[model samples]
Target chain A: MPHLAVNNLRAKYGALEVLKGVSFSIEKGQVVALVGPSGSGKSTVLRTLVGLTPVTGGNVTIHDDKIDYASSGSLRRARDQMAIVFQQYNLFQNMRIIDNVTVAPVKIKKRPKDEARADAERLLAMVGLADKLNAFPDQLSGGQQQRVAIARALALHPEILLLDEVTSALDPELVNEVLDSIRQLAKDGMTMILVSHEMAFVREVADKVVFMDGGSVVEEGLPEVLFDAPKTDRAREFFGKILRH
Target chain B: MERILEQIPRFFTADNMALLLQSAGLTLAMTVAGCVIGFGLAFVLVYLRQTPGRWALPLRVICVAYVEVFRRIPFIVVIYLVLFFIQTVASNASLFTIAVISICIYAIAYTAEIIRGGLESVPLTQMEAARAMNFGRLRTLVTITLPQAWPVILPPAIAFAVSFIKDTALVSQIGVFELTFRGKELNNQGYSGILVFGTIAMCYFLMSFPLSMLGQYLEKRLATPRSEQSARKIRRT
Candidate 1:
């Protein structure tokens, strides 16, 4: 069975529908990149998975544990196995870097402070933020903050990590550092579904590429197959427009 | 100026000074109790406003109504109503009890609004981030939302506290014999109104000035950069 599967997911903001019937699945240790034009419901797909956006109709399953989107208990249980890092890096401005990474483990998982602290230190070290343990989010550059956000997500020991345009907000120069940390995670065999605009990085890191438009999956295949050879005209057009710029 | 200075000593006669001290204590007691208790009520109001599900709709409506009614109506009017109404129904209730209840009701409304503003100022992503990490609702509020909102909440909360101390003066209308009421009594007993009222004003200033300064101090302390705070700690070590 696929490690994570989202089927016929339907979500809306209000009167406007964003995700009509989006579907995708990822195997264990697989890295899938979701690329699409703006408002293609790429980020919303991640939000719905994490329970930040409510799914009107859908079924999300992890390792044969199925959750109907309408049920709160199922959503909560499914979300525990998953974590998301947002584009803006959304670090708690009130906490130090160490505290930011440790808070979820200690507060949610009921881990001891010392144990959580050690884990946070290890995760921060992984992201190259070990020296800045006491620094505030505001003190770090945009890229460093995003790395801390990644370490924070990792501290939860999530089986699946979701990246919602994680590097879109960075400077052109700073993007690589954040991407490199993600590359390290991929090397470690972490399962991730990333929504990104960085086409080159997506092509390099993703095992599978899913192209979406108008709130539905247009075409998806292996990166080389999808990027190099287009099966659908919509995919061909999207690649044509985005690759030119 | 000479007359006012002379009256200061007269006001400090052992009996008069005792009464002044007693009234000062009562005023401080009521304000502190009101503030602390009202803060509890405000917490409930804020939670009710944020709760989800069907019951939350009515709870939110009730919270909005409670805030609007208590905030829009004058505290003095509320005190008068509580004082006279309680007298008719429960003659044995102490005036002090009635006074504290009245002040708390008024303070709860304003405090709830200030707290709500603080909560709203916190970015929605903070809650999302906490929830994404599997933190439950109450845990998210306590651990993530509240801590972030606290710095924003403090200044307004303390400003309200200072104003709360002043608002206690309104309770004097119910004959509670707190500082302002006692000041009036002293004035009626043949001291110049200027001397008597001015002294009370100074006492209010003494209480409020420190509170305002404490608010300033807390804001600065909390605002200190974490890096600097850690660096300072390291230097001391």
Candidate 2:
């Protein structure tokens, strides 16, 4: 069994079915990039993995333990194993950078405050935010804030990290810094699932690239196989439009 | 006009001025006490788990009804009801205590509504981010939610405090010697009702004007930053 598996995942918002029987599996230490156009339910898949969005019908098994959405207690237990970095960089604006990174470890993990603070300092240093420990989210640039957010996600020591269009909200100049941090994490053997529009970053970092369209997976293969040569006409057309830019 | 000038000395007599000072003290005491209790209860009302099935719901409903009922009736009537009617039923209650209790209850209702509006104005995203950090619900509310909400809530809260002080005059109807009562007493004693009332209005203006200015200062201070601090830091580097 893979480290994370989504078997026949179905999700709906009110009456509209956004994800229809989507199935995929990711092995441990594999960096899989889910690439698709807008409204392809790519972000929704990451959300469902964390139980942020209610999964209508699906089996999301993380390391052999299935997430039970009906039971919040069980879902919370399952969620502790993974971390998610949002496109919006949802860093707590009211908290200082160190506090934002340390909060979950201290509160949820019940780690000592001193230990959590020390861990946070190390994580911030890792993300090139060593001097921004006392700064608030609003006090940081978009790149710095996203770096802080990535550090916050890593502080949990999660088995799998979900990146939902992490660099889409950033300026063109700032995108490389965030992508560099992610590439470093991948080099350190962290299993990551990214939903991003940065095709160049996707080509460089992802071991396997999965193309999703209209709430279902259209194609999945190694980046070389998928990017350099197209098996399907839909994949070829989609790749042509995005690669030209 | 000359005779009235002689009467001004009598108006400022030691005993009369002492009574006026005492009234001012009592009014301040009542207003401050009411504000603290009212705001405290209102905080709970706004954030406490009072949904239909929660244990807090009944208490919340009771609190809501209490506020609505007291808020609708005039303050004078509420004071009168507490002093005369409640006193008749539960004798041995101190009149001073009754007056203070009535004002606090009235203040809670209005303050709760103001606080509820402030609480609602806080984006749900703030709370969700706090939750993602795994902070307990109560911790999230106090440290994350309340701090941000306070700057928004403070102006209206101060405005309510000023209004509460003005409303203290209504308690004089139940025989509390607030500023208005002193003015009324002076008027009855041939001190010229216009001059006495004018002085009373001046006293209120003195108290309320400073607070209104403070509210404006706070509102300006709490205005969301226009220049992005993050972008500025990046430019400096």
Candidate 3:
């Protein structure tokens, strides 16, 4: 059985169904990338998994435990197992960098402040932001702030990390600093579901690439197969268009 | 002019000065107590108003109605309603309490919108980040949302409170011994209108000017760049 299975998951924003029976599975320690054109609902899958978007139909199972989105307790448990870094690097603007990383761990997880701070320092160091511990989010560059967001997510000790177009909002020159941090996480064998437009980065890090369009999966396979030689016309056209740059 | 000049000496008497001082204190107390309580309660109202379920529709409606209805009604009308409503329930409730309640009711309505706007000014992504980390609603609010919202909320909130100090005169209609009521009382006692009211005006100015200055200071402080604040902190040490 897969470690985490999203079987025919569905969601909607009012009458517009965004995730029409999307299904995928992730084994432990594997990096999966969700790639597609804008508004193809690539991000919605991660959102539904974390309960940010309400799951209108279907379910997710982790180790065969079907997540009940209706129950706050179940959702909390699911959230505890996964942490998502947003595309905008939504660091709490009120907090300093160290506080941003340690807040969830200390406040929500009820972990010891000392241990959480130590782990936070380690995570910041890992993301190459050790000297920026006291700085506010607005004080840093976009790439630095994005790295802090990644460190913030890592401090939670989540089994699965969701990166929702983490570098999509960065300057071209600033993009690699963030991707480099994610590359380090990938090297450490962190389980992550990445939604990205960077075809090269996706190919470099993704164990499997799930290509979605019009709110459902069109094709998914090893990154090599999907990128070098796509199966479907849609996948071929998407890769062909995006890869030309 | 001669009449006013003669009355100025009488008005400057220690007894009259004491009364005016006391009245000014009462006005400040009414504004601070009412607006502080009301501002706090507005958070609860905004929270209820944003409840996201079909079952909470009535709750959302009720919260919305409270803000809408109270905000639309004049402050003086709210004063009278609260004055009479409380009198019916507990006749012994002091006029000061009644006046505070009136101002609080009005403040809650006005500040609810201010607070809601401030909270909304924070991008939805901040809350989403907090939610994905398993931060409960109240925790996210207290820990994340409210702190970030302070910059947007405070200047306007303080402005309301400072302005509401003048509005507290309307409560004197129910015979609260606030500045305006006391001014009227002194005028009724044959003190010149210009003399008594001019002093009362001075008292109101004394009360609100400092508060407005504090509000401005806070606005500047909250808007200061974080780097500057850190530099100041380091310099202070």
Candidate 4:
């Protein structure tokens, strides 16, 4: 069974529907890259999955347990099993990097302070931020901040991770450091669903590429097939415009 | 001017000085009581305004109404209303009770608005980040939002508190026997206006100056960039 499945997911912000019956599934170890143009509901899908966007319709199943989007308890339970890294690195500005990584485990999971701190140290080490543990978010470069965010997400021990344009906000030269950390996670078999505009990074790291447009999946397949061959005129035009840029 | 300066020494006679001291004590007591009560009510008002739910909606509307009505009216009028209004309900209400309640009622409206501004100054993304980390709303508010909002909240609150110190003079209208009331009595007894008024004004200045200085000091210290603070702390360690 798929580790996570989003079936007929519908979401909106007041009158405007952003995700219209979007469906996708991720197995336990697969990295699914969601690629699309701006406002194509790619990021909305991730937001909906995390229960930030109120789901107007449909259901999500995690590990074979299904729940409606409106149930707070079930949604929170589902959310506790996953984590997200945003386009803007929303680190707690008041906290040191180590505290930022450890806060969730200690507060939400009720882990002991020492255990949480040790876990945070280990995760910081994993993300190449061991020396910066005492630093604040504002003290670091954008790439370092994003890497800290990734370590924070991993600190939760989420079964699946969500990356919403993680490197899009970085300077071009700083993009590789964050993408490299994500690539290393992919190598270590961390399941992640990423929404990205960096077609090259998506192609390199994504095992299965899903093409989205106008709030629906246009085409999805292996990266080689989707990138090289045209299954649909819309996707082909999208790739043509993106690659030409 | 020479006569006024000479009179200042006579104003410190034992009886006059004792009344001035007692009145100053009362003024300090009223300011402290008003701040404690007003801040508590303002906290409730801000929480109601910010929280989402059907139950909180009416309470929030009531809070908005409370802030608007109290803020728009004069503090002296509120004091008069509370003082006279209390007499109709209870003939023997203490001046202390009337003074604290009136100042608190007036300060709550202003404090609520100032605190709401502080709350809004915190970025929306901060709350979203906290929620995504599986934090409950209360924990997110106390731990994540309040710490960031503190720097923004403090200066205004201190300003209000110092203003409350001056505002306590208005309570003298209801025979609270505070500094200004004692000044009026001393003036009635043939004390020079310069001596009586100057003494009360000096007392007011003494009370408010330290608080304003503290506000300025905190604004400068907290205004330093978070990264700079962390770096400085790291160096210290």
> Mind listing the fnat for each candidate?
0.89, 0.29, 0.97, 0.91
Ranking by lDDT: 3, 1, 4, 2
Candidates 3 and 4 compared: the better one by DockQ is: 3
Residue B200 CA displacement from its true place in model 4, Å: 1.3
Off by over 4 Å in 2: A228-234, B1-3, B49-85, B224-237
lDDT tens digits, residues B135-232, model 1? 88888788778988888898889888888888899888888999999998998897988988887898888888998999999988777876787679
The Cα error of candidate 4 at residue A89, in Å, is: 1.0
Give the Cα-based TM-score of candidate 2 against the true structure.
Answer: 0.88
Q: Which candidate achieves the best DockQ against the true structure?
A: 3
Highest lDDT: give the candidate number. Answer: 3
The CA lDDT at B66 in model 4 is: 95
- Is candidate 1 or 2 superior in lDDT? 1
Ten contiguous residues minimizing lDDT sum, candidate 2 chain A = A70-79
List of clashing residue pairs for candidate 4: none
Give model 2's DockQ, 2 decimals: 0.33
lDDT of 4 at B19: 84
**lDDT accuracy of residue B1 in candidate 4:** 80
Q: Count the backbone clashes (under 3 Å) in each candidate.
A: 0, 1, 0, 0
- Cα lDDT of model 2 by residue, B4-99, tens digit: 677777777788778777777788888888788878877776665334335667877776787678779877777877787777788887666887
lDDT of each: 0.90, 0.83, 0.93, 0.89
Clash pairs, candidate 2, are A140-B230
For candidate 4, write residues A85-151 as lDDT tens digits: 9999899988889999999999899999999999899988888899999888888999999999999
After superposing candidate 3 on the true structure, give the runs of residues whose Cα lies further than 4 Å from its correct spot.
Answer: B235-237
